[model samples]
Target: KIKEEINKRIKEKIKGILPGLLEEEIEKITSAKEEELKKGVERIIEDYQPLKEENKIITKLFRLLGDKTAYAAEKKPVEKTKIEIEIEWIELFNPYEVPCEVEGWQIKTSLGTRALGGIISSDSYRFIFNMVIRMPGKSIGKEILGDNGDTVILTNKRRNIVDKVSYRGYGLPWSAWEKNDPRSREFASILPGGSPGFRNWFWMPEVGEAKNKNDYSSFYVKDKPFANTGEIVFIHSGEWRTIRLEQGGEWQILDKITVADPPEKPVQGRININTASKQVLEALPGIDSALSQAIINYGNSKKRPFNEIGEILQILLLARLGSNGKDDDKDGYTDEEDEREAIFRGLSNLITTRSNCFTVISRGEVVKNDEIVAERKIKAVIDRGSSPIKIKYYRELSED
Candidate 1:
């Protein structure tokens, strides 16, 4: 009877401890499985494509770590505005046959409106200065034009809108927007001191009318190599001779001098080789009239234009000879290839095969087992003239 009593007590004690141990073991297993599941989800979320609506559940669960980890995948870069130039004067052009009377008219800008009291002659230009248009109670000599962009509207005494123009200044010193084609109402940017009281430098008359280039003839040096002396050298004239600047910026041509040495610093602008005329090609150092013609002919022969600046070498070979591989230069060498190679190296940075403004599309893909798993595309507008070469526009294209 005594042994039976001891055995009953032992069984009760064993049962009590067994339930506790079982509960502890269950908790350990559940914790381990939950941790493994969480890690698997974390890996999936880490490699996920840029956040979409479908991944919100995973993104929220991942945020339990007290961080927005999903958004860190792709962060958009901050884009800055292009530098702008301020203007103190505004120009007005009259393209019609009859003159305009503006005694009781008003000119409207973003800042304020100024009363107009002058007559703009027919086929003429007029300039309004900043002091004349200063707003009332503002500081003396405030600029009328915005540094980045502005809209100028003109209205007559009857409050009828006469003309309005919207323009952006690209921070280029001494540049202004002027109508490029007098026949059309559209305007274009004119560089280096715009024509204030005369026709624009880039004015293109009607199709049959003779272009009056004499207005800008004083500023342009025809068929002359640049001397880095602040004078503008018009590149499209044939067989540019080396120009030496005399006193008062007068150009003295030296026929004996052929090649112009490269400037010490990289120039601000570049010419498109694909679109430049033969005369413009002659403007480069060591490129003569014969070479320029060869380039034009080579460009014409190719169905597709040059894709890169290096492709000019093929035309340079034709320039070595008269395109028939004969001794055209009469330098006693028929296929002397070194001369053309030197020219290519000299003109590389100054020339481009494309325009100043172009679009760039970039794509990226994740592939697995010969199949695309994920893909992304981005499009941007690249303006080469802008300083620091920032993207003017950007967008994420939907995957097709």
Candidate 2:
């Protein structure tokens, strides 16, 4: 019985792991002689039963094994992690065609870094393409701006931005403004700000007021009232500016500019099982392109949604693969289908009840060589359930 149980469990496991493989293939792999297979299965059950008795300990042991194995194997060679490709949004003057050049733009982040350089655009948003940078072998001592002005490196951390720096007096270096102008100096010294100007401008009104009139700046611009002040400022200007109310008064600067990132396109939604393309269906879990196509074909022929999962099993079974009665080859039922059908049948059988009749004998005396028996026994069987067996005159009768 133990062996039988193990064999059953092994069969179930094989069916689950390789649903596409035929039962014969599974049998070949397990290669257990009938009796040996049964013994092996029984042993597996015996081993598991004790563990099940101590469920908590067994579960923890398994989890620890998995974690430790993974940690220890971390040094082994692995496939490269997928890199997220950087997408560049270029500015176009025609709103359709790519731009020839973009000017007077600077990229900045919410962080304090400012003056991250951006490129020129005549058509769309101006952006650099295929930009790549490697990390330093050792940590850099302090934070410094990269050559493009769009990157800020601090120790091992680096940030990228999209915006062009606005030079004062055309050819003047960005560092020159740092000393002469407080706002320009602040913007250049800190991390890049959001589009138009440094992010600090939104918090510090004085900084917004200090930028050069012609230089572009970016700040957090909102139509709503400032958090500090319950009142809203509705000032409109052709150039970008950050407005904020300080303890002294409202501060607005003409040099402040706005910087905006390129808009992203919407993504396509999940594929419909009924009408999905082969590629779309193939992307689904546990489904291949061929299976997806087969599904479509089956659905088209039936002209309706499958009533139950079992129907698919039936279809696959009817389509079996090989010349042998048991061996289903290509274009026929897959091993997966058979396993699924078996599981479905098992579930269905569990709910069914048997009803039948039986008989029982009561009060019988045993005799040897025509001599009357000394002991008497009583037994009775009733038509209660499915099995029809003759009851011996020894056990108590059951009422039905």
Candidate 3:
């Protein structure tokens, strides 16, 4: 009954203005845009069907207006709900600003939409969101924008669009991407090395610098060597640590990955796989102590040094690389390759023996729906070739 009452009132309002509105907008249909206008008019005309016999001119005039403006005179208007959401900051673009109030609003990206924890106070006039848009629930990916074109929409409780960002044609990526560095969201405004978050490391490639800065590294005795992180004998699968620099110019532990509840693969700047000790290898996913040993043994046995990281996948047969640069496992690939082709089968940014730069990829199991499951990849690079492995380049891989 309330809906009917609203519609009746809306119709009366439309009838009052239709005559003037039609005079302003009605046009002869010619091109595609004109045809679209005609269709919109026909939609409104349909609402007043009885007018076909009562008054043709009155019905035709409706074509000059939008469906809502023309047809409200005949049909009920469903009250469309509205919610106001303010885009606070885009981490890849405006990360330096204050974090957004993302409690209640829902964010949708090309990858998927995740709901906020509803932990924000909404008494203010606006809602802000610093949307990460990572996978929410059982969805597929978190890189929501598309290459050709994409739209990110913010909606309220009733799913009415509050705000949206739309882009068309092939443009810039949402984050920066370097050859061996993690493939970050290539935001249109962000260049390859420019940090949209207003921060970027000075590429320090010298090991002396890394040591001067008191960073961690494996001191090899020229072959039968191993690695340790100052305290641990060898890095464990979950032993990978995320560190940051302190004001005193020393490396400080920012967070450590817990085996029971590991964070998404912590990005490790490249640890020269060519020179990285077995202990270091053990810290990576799909690698146990035994596999690490085997990798070391295999390194000795190979005839030629790997030309590139992807070549190691072929040497270990972890992934069979055809000339075309794709994993051809359908012909019978197993083990890590068989387990998952996307991560294990390729070493695009890994497995380098000479560049003296390396990346460590780690994945952790997180409980989702009461079950432990694995998630995305992150990479970090350390260029030992530099006089002082400048700075460890680490970043989470964008899912686009």
Candidate 4:
């Protein structure tokens, strides 16, 4: 039946041939175009409902026909949908000499919105941490200040926006980057880290020459063999030690005495209090072996790591207030309030609760009829410490 139908259709297609053509010439032309006729027959059979009634006959007929032509309709190229996210910017533009209280201000990020407290001193910057802005029970580093990229929005107490900024995490931490500047955010020459609470290190501090003789003189006097009255100086014995001149102006150095070196020079850069080891913590000023161990203990005992630098004071206060010189969780302070405060204040600028880098993975897909037709994934390493943020590394990923 299929063969009869195909032959009838081919004859109908040949009916318009010129009258000059003989029967044999028409037969030759029809035979030469048999393949073309087959394709047309196949399409017609598929479209004709009556021909589709019998699945077996349809299948047999298609087998008799040739494979599809290259010109046949090709599947539509895979198209991916675009994803958009809302972002807000933050900027402070106060020129008043007096400090402005930012209490009740709000910071909105991709993760969520966080309220601000405390004052932003005139001509100074305040670095707020995720712990202060994130909702309770949220993780510190990943929640608000997205390690990969994020939009930051600042609103005043009246809910009016002050400023906003968007950044893609990429360059090294501590390096300065300005939006208007043509320079790249990633600086290969500078090491990782940044000046968060202060100005960028690229600028030099304005220092004037000493105006008075006293200002030019060194705090410690040298070249004088005999110590002056009420003078304190370092004496070299078996080990360097400090000696004071009494009322008689006489100073004696201890023989074969061992002493630790004086405090190290102040170092730049901040350490993540959430991840630093006890040994690393001890390297900071006012943090001795005992205090370092207390910090570690406090960090471990808590459900989460330190969310802000100020939280370290709670541990220091507990250590200072504990009885018998043992670390404890005592609630009140004693005569050691000043000492504890000194320790906390010393570390305020040297510690951070979040990491400098973050990894972000994003996947995109094209879907049809509830099934994924095409997919692509990307992995990026973002450096949040840089002023404008940087993408340290990026690569396309695949699913095995």
The number of the candidate with the highest TM-score is 1
Please estimate how well model 2 matches the true structure, expressed as its whole-model Cα lDDT: 0.31
lDDT of 3 by residue, 1-400 (tens): 2223223333333333323334222221112133433444454434333323433222112221222221223323332221111111232221111234454667787766757434333212122222111111221113344547666677767788755666555344333221112221222332332232222221111111112224554221223221111111122222232121212211122123122123343334555566778867755533555556766777678855544343343333332222324323322222211222222312223333455556777555578898866566677877665565654787777543
lDDT digits (tens) for residues 1-400 of candidate 4: 4335444433333332223435775566456445644554454334233323333232121111222111111123222211111111123433334477999999888788878788877556554432111111221123556656666678889999766666665544422222211111222113222333333322211111223454532233334432111122323222222332221222222112212132232222568888888768866644667777887888889869876554665653333522345222122333322222333423544566778777899999999999999999999999876667889999999775
Please report how far candidate 4 places residue 265 from its true position, in Å: 21
Clashing pairs in 1: none
Order the numbered candidates by lDDT, best leading. Answer: 1, 4, 3, 2
Model 1 worst lDDT window (10 residues)? 59-68
The stretch of ten residues in a row with the least summed lDDT in candidate 4 is 63-72
TM-score on alpha carbons, each prediction: 0.28, 0.16, 0.23, 0.25
Better of 1 and 3 by lDDT: 1
Which stretches in model 4 have alpha-carbon errors above 4 Å?
1-269, 274-307, 316-318, 321-335, 341-346, 354-356
What are the per-model C-alpha RMSD values against the true structure? 36.1, 38.9, 23.9, 34.2
TM-score of 3: 0.23
Q: How many angstroms is residue 281 displaced in model 1 relative to the true structure, after the best TM-score fit?
A: 40
| TM value for model 2 | 0.16
